[model samples]
Target: MKKWAILVAVMLLAINFSFSNGAGEAEAGGKEVVLVYDGDAFFSLISTSLAFHEGKVPMLLFKDDLAVQQKFIDDYGADGLIVVGRHVDAALPCREFLGDAVAVSLKIAEFFGKSSSVVVMPCSMDEYNLSLIATPIACYTDAPILLYDDNDDEIISAIDKLGAENVIGIGSVAIGNVHLKSEEEIYDYISDIRDVGYLAVTNPDDALKPEVTESQEMSFERHMKNIQITILSQKINLVGSDEATFSISVPDGISRIRAIVDVP
Candidate 1:
């Protein structure tokens, strides 16, 4: 009777462990594949949207240490890997998107098949802000975000091949029948859908760094406050008085700002 009880207890523990492991895998959305990219390259970051569009797979920056990368895969329970960038070489069962940003974008689009629409944004390998804004929109819309150049034959050809009826352009990109939008306009449009949350702003000077370690949450918080100040200043401008005095109150717990005597 004692031996039977011990055996039952061990079996129960094994079943519980298996259940919890299955639960974790389900929580990870059964996405047992992760995309790896070189954090040191700006283009690598931009191309990550391909992975995002491909089943919303998770992405990790490629650490120099192979052990670290393998550990991440184990933690995420991922069995397969997709590597982006020509220089990134991951030692695993993986598919590689190897090329320049434009080439990689086109290849990924072709690999995932086409949609009725394609997002065309100005391509700047050095600047990331515009691409960052475009990534989520592309993923949400289920359209491929192609880096645009002025009258580039390759981009025009890709758009034609994709059979994209709607060519949505962001930030001064003027392709054929493309709907161009300014940065401010894009911000206003996405503000409705995007939750106001902490942002991690990367420094342009440190674009080539292997990893980003600083938190810019406080800086972003201040930027939000500045937007408030700008709105208040605009309202004050509506008074249309050359010499009007007004008191500005700073909310509690908010950082103080310099007096805006003559904000133009």
Candidate 2:
């Protein structure tokens, strides 16, 4: 009997997500910022909380049930109001009242014109985390944020609805996975736009420590056929070896790593 075991170790990659010094100023010099959130706790927490914290933009929970919108208008007295989604009623007085997240975002992008971009994310709980991750980009670009989910067919129907063509995605979001890229790539893209410091560190010891390691059996016949494993984009080939031990070398600057083995 021939047995083989492959030990894979990956180091943790740390990237700097610290807020920019003048990020708050990006939202200033325009108007007293008001973010019209859907008022859903989960959605607001992940979507607008960081924007409020980073850009000094106060969030107004826009729910149709509450008639406090007028109070918000009177107290804050915002020069312009930007709505995150259409579900909320816009009774506030403003130069314009836009409907739907996409539409509202487009209205704000008008200020930046050709230099503007929009941040899109899935509306479901699983995907809303990207909103928080991408909030800094939104604040920096002064872009509008739009969210979508699997069920909402109208989610993407409004992407180009407002005539804003420069579109960017934060996490597991795209035009049907056509531009599926790694998270590091997205962060790098944001860094390019903002020119901020990014740091990444890798620690593999914690990840590889396991009580039990899975083993595999290779017969003479299978050994003659050869075996291979693929991790990320790297591949390791095992041919005619009864037993072997090896350590894979991953290049620096790679923010993430994953290992996969296929058995047939």
Candidate 3:
């Protein structure tokens, strides 16, 4: 089955939620950064930023990685949240990575307006850690969805056309089922602003292994630049926040490039 097995556990206890009614003023116009993660590591990252700058904690749940962070904000339209990722990926899922910033900004009014908001670094991510969000994307009620995976060109093109018609079209390739398009064609195809997705990466070594030729990387970046929509990737950083830098150790050989939504 392409779908992952998600273990859902509800916190009946007064789960240490971050929303503090008395913590700070609404500051109606101030930019509020959302730290999306489920454990101490991500919380600590949010705390570190608080050390240098003041912030308002979001009441929403989150993961330590930027990918998941973006996913939550995009779907539910929260104040903002963090994302997660593995350090070993060769090609970073740009759509999922970009979700952290875009989702929060679009949902949070202050961020959408002209303001100097730096989304704050997405909670530092790690491996396939359990994030708070293990739910499926059910964003739109009436939109038709087309499921595709690696090498399903026929289905992908169909989605593009449907989306162009302003139809609520969703792709199930966030599970890494869809194949990567050729470098040049990907740019033109995914550049449209109406696209959205849930992303996943089943092959970490292929995505993170550092062996891309300069030409290849350029093609990859070119494809990424054209992606204005959101996507998903696996290896979520679901660790919640604490009072330090949300830190996660990537297995040896992962890329050193930093991931997640940026607020710093």
Candidate 4:
């Protein structure tokens, strides 16, 4: 008889500074700078993307390394900084927004002015995957994505302040004028406005740690079968294998992965 053990890993890809589109054009006091939370402040992370996009500012991670932050400031010639989350001893003239996730998100939305629509997702940690999906849509649609708690009234007030004509809810949440109940529905809705593709690939244990080439390319054909679709007049193929393996490349980085496989 063959014995089988299944191992699963879910990787939560941290939103890094490299994701920013560079610094925004300078304003009156100085150039607009990106504000980042030093910790796993999920709501702040989602809200900041909208703020940065609307403001057209560059973003950097706020870790214990003040020197790195200072270098970013000097390199960009930034005179003022907008600090998100808790207060920090910034190296430049800065404005801080401090509060819980809901408060912080409301502040960000208020700072950027108003929006015509709002995207609301569950605030609990378990619903992070939904937030991840909703984020890009919010940014692209120029809408604010707020984390909603069933008991929380502040979200309602925040929506009122935004004067949003449309409210979009992800999952089974009670809010939103329109609710997207599943991943496929969310993807389909966004696809109408933009091209979207999702791929999940699994590999055997030995194949997980491929050689870290300068190009950082992994041969998908070796591990998985191909799935294809057409969006916006473009063709996209998603490939995945039956075997499951998981690993993380960054030290001290947060990742979540889920894998299911049969083994002996």
Candidate 5:
């Protein structure tokens, strides 16, 4: 009889373990992944929104009561929980991933099955205008926005481990070796830098990299050829467009090897 009791206890433990690991499949199957943030705080909301843009998940304002938070998660059928803010505690049945806005974004990106290319924005809400600028950029790039601080060693290491190819810095702040693509001077800089590329437009679109079309008026000349161009570094390929003209500027005795290229 004792042996049977022991066997039943073992089976129960196994079942609990299964539920813990597969909570999404067991309870929230076919539901959208959800992000839980401390809604009372504006900074938390905005920072968490960065991840939401990438995760494409609904946001659930976290309640102090664990039961209330659990119900909210159940109501939405959240496959995963990304808890934002340092103080917010999640006691959900599923896996509870915790981090500040920037750190959480890395987890959210993995949830969406995207490569970890992230946009670095200012950490404080005082730079709200800068954050506003970064939002569309993040959406277009399909990357999470990480708040920047010089001492953010953990965030820096996380980004490195992600094998991130393009780490874009928005606004005036410089994080790491990121070049400011928002300025006009980047055009000249592009030519000088070996692997640098430029994307210019009379009217910029919501796309991180805009599409280039052929321009019949602007034909490629012989001297204007073979200049290497790319979009977001290497994410997209570009070619010359008849709609766009490639003009080369070289000093005396220097050859104009290529005219210009358009991003495809």
Candidate 6:
């Protein structure tokens, strides 16, 4: 290849990389297999790698669109996409919250199938959504999901009475009071939860290294364990004993990302 031709190719490659990673003359890697979650599901969804503070709700909302989600599939050659949802309401437009979520789930199932994989975590309607309606909220939603309840005893008892096989618990419901402190403090919280025969699913705040309970180390004032966890019932038999495996999907190129969505 001519030197000039090679130079042109390099320049074009740089431009493409900039275009995909960011706007304004950024370049994207052609062979990098950059998975873009081009779906609306990620719009407001939060990740755990962020610093928590007041007014940081955007860090934890499920607002991605379809286009982005599909792109991720194409780019990664991903085998499966589990459409896990944060929080959903029971009553609402049949097509809006739970309705749309179910639709997304179906689309994923149909598109990926046994080949690649696409599925949604249909919402659950439990007490937390109800509590939000009774109190103040950052935003309004009709997604179907259960609430964390924030109390450890309530969650464990729920699993025991309801049977762990029938359901899985999410979020800091395991950490309890210690969550208000620092990441190191969270250990005691986790210990407390485990003692009760419950599990604590990891999120951005806890997943990220040096988990800072306060928003920032210096400004160590305002912080939030204020997020919620949502769940869906499995085909679990109420008579069987089982534990739900909890995990969060991190954005491409981001490590240790953790964040929870609306609870219950």
Clashing pairs in 1: none
TM-scores for every predicted model: 0.56, 0.39, 0.19, 0.59, 0.44, 0.22
Ranking by TM-score: 4, 1, 5, 2, 6, 3
Q: Model 6 shows how many backbone clashes?
A: 52
Model number with the top TM-score? 4
lDDT of each: 0.52, 0.44, 0.28, 0.58, 0.45, 0.24
Better candidate number, 1 or 6, judged by TM-score: 1
Please report the candidate that would top lDDT against the real structure: 4
User: Per-residue alpha-carbon lDDT of model 6 for 23-98, expressed as tens digits?
Assistant: 2332323222111122333211211101011111111122354443445344443222122333322111111112
Off by over 4 Å in 5: 1-28, 39-55, 63-80, 86-92, 99-116, 176-264
Residue 35's lDDT in candidate 1: 44
Question: What lDDT tens digits, residue by residue, belong to model 1 across residues 29-97?
Answer: 344343445643545444555555555555666655455667757776664555666444444345566
Scored against the true structure, residue 232 in model 4 reaches a CA lDDT of 97
Better of 1 and 6 by lDDT: 1
Model 4: per-residue Cα lDDT over 120-170, one tens digit each: 877776666556555556755677767776745877888888898888888
Estimate the TM-score for candidate 4.
Answer: 0.59
Mind giving the per-residue lDDT tens digits that candidate 5 earns over 1-264?
A: 000000000000001211133335444343433335564233343444344343445445655644566665666545544444434444443444466555555554444444446666666555544454345344445565566655477557656765677876655557646655453322232334343122223223222233343323344544333344566776432544324445644557542233455544
After best superposition, candidate 4 residue 230: deviation in angstroms? 68
Q: Which ten-residue region of model 5 has the weakest summed lDDT?
A: 3-12
> How does candidate 4 score on lDDT?
0.58
